[model samples]
Target: MHPDDLSAAAEVHRLAFVRQKQSEQWLASTLAAFPRFLCFVAEEAGQVLGFILWAQKSGFRDQAVLELDQLAVLPAAQGRGIGRRLIVQSLPLVREQLVRQGSSLKHVIVNTRADNHAQKLYRDTLGAQVEATIRDLYSADEVFMVARQVDEGARGR
Candidate 1:
């Protein structure tokens, strides 16, 4: 996402994640991280509707493990497939960035409250599956999901 979109994106973050505070600072820091933390926003008619953040996990290597760090859409825009579009659209761009760094995406990891319905979205889009569950990790039980060998899956798309 461009620096100019920070405020609008942060608004979406605030609305999507009500429990989280300091939206501007959180978004600004992540945006500044660049290649290590790739951030993309979905906008229409100059209005930011949603965003997706992917972070390279651990040290960089030939095969990179990425975390689907954060996905947020304005509450009013929810259930309209903006979140799905964010994932389907930004992932290829992320793959291209990794390729330029002489790296390829190996797998993707996502963790969320067990009850969150977005698990289905991850499954459909990234082929992510729940690998583990940590009780009371945050506000509730958190499930760790992973999509293995994404290089092939990513290529097919």
Candidate 2:
């Protein structure tokens, strides 16, 4: 996603995640600061519909993991599998970047409200399994999930 889409992307988050509202300026600047962040937007005829942003962790090298930093789909765009498409489409790009760095994509991680039904979506779409839980991590319990895609390579650690 480019800086031009930040405002619309922020609007999507505000509408989709009614519980959280972040300034578009902050979101755009934060994304800019993360060179390794991979962001994608679902667009139609020049209008933004949704977006997903992921960033590498653990120093972005061997054994590094990816965190789904944020995802949002416009209220009108939900229930249409936009989120699923974002993940599916971003994987090959992520893999290409890792290969370019001579590194491997080690794991995929995401966090969400423990009671949220979207857990199923993350599990089914991303192969992520709840690996940890923290009470009152936010307004409710938060779950950290992982899809262990590079277990053999990760074993080096």
Candidate 3:
């Protein structure tokens, strides 16, 4: 996402994640993190409908583990495959950035509410499987899903 898209992306975040406050500030900080935190927006007709945040976990290495930090879509724009597209399209871009840094993606990890239907999307898109579940974590039970050996999966597309 470009710097100019921050406000619009922040609005999506605000609407998608109503429990989260300071949308603009949160997104701005994540954007400033740059290579450590790769942020991408899904837009159509010059409007940001959604965004995804992928973060490099731990320190830099020859192999990188990425966290699907956040995914948000405006309420009005939900169920349109925008979130799925963000994952499918931006992942290659993320891999390119990792390649430039002498690292290849090794794994992707995601933590989401256990009851969230997005788990199916993660499974279908990233080959992610639930490895653990933390009870009463962040508004509900949180499941940690991992897609291992992802570099061998063509960016998990």
Candidate 4:
């Protein structure tokens, strides 16, 4: 997303997370440095209803692991499969980037609030596995759950 889209994107982010205002400068800077970091929006009649931003990074211990940095859909648009569509579109981008970098991606990892209903959509609906649970990682009262998508060839193993 560009600096111009920050206002709209921030609005979506604010509605989704109920947190501090997202910085336009930060988004612009990050997008400039990493163009592959995607910000996808669901728009109808020229109005953006929701968005999902995601970035892929090599894991610290395993270079073959691709970590999803962020994913969120506006609260008003939730439960309509917009989030799932974003994730589904992102899988190929992740695979393409890995191939271009000559890396063999073995899995995709995402982190979400442990009690979040979205967790079931990602885990049960999308077939992601809970890889780990980090207590109080984001806040004193919140727990973080790491979910993983193993490559098709590694699914049964």
Clashing pairs in 3: none
Per-residue lDDT tens digits of candidate 2, residues 47-140? 8999888888868677568888777788888888878888777777777777888777778899999998878878777778999999998899
Clashes of each: 0, 0, 0, 0
> Candidate 1: lDDT over CA atoms?
0.91
Per-residue accuracy of model 4 over 35-140 as CA lDDT, tens digit each: 3465556665766666556555543233465555556666777777767666666566655666676655555566777777766656643456676677777743
Summing lDDT over every window of 10 consecutive residues in candidate 2, give the lowest-scoring window.
148-157
Candidates' C-alpha lDDT: 0.91, 0.78, 0.91, 0.59
Residues 1-157, candidate 3, lDDT per residue (tens digit)? 8789999999998888888899999999999999999999998999999999999999888999999999988889998988889998888999999999999999999999999999998998898999999999888999999998764433333
What's the lDDT for residue 34 in model 4? 55
Write model 1 residue lDDT over 104-129, tens digit each, in one string: 99899999999999898888888899
C-alpha lDDT (0 to 100) for residue 24 of candidate 2: 82
lDDT of 4 at 68: 57
Error of 2 at 15 (Å): 1.3
**Candidate 3 whole-model C-alpha lDDT, 0 to 1:** 0.91
Better of 1 and 4 by lDDT: 1
Worst 10 residues of 3 by lDDT: 148-157
What is the alpha-carbon RMSD of candidate 2 to the true structure?
Answer: 4.7
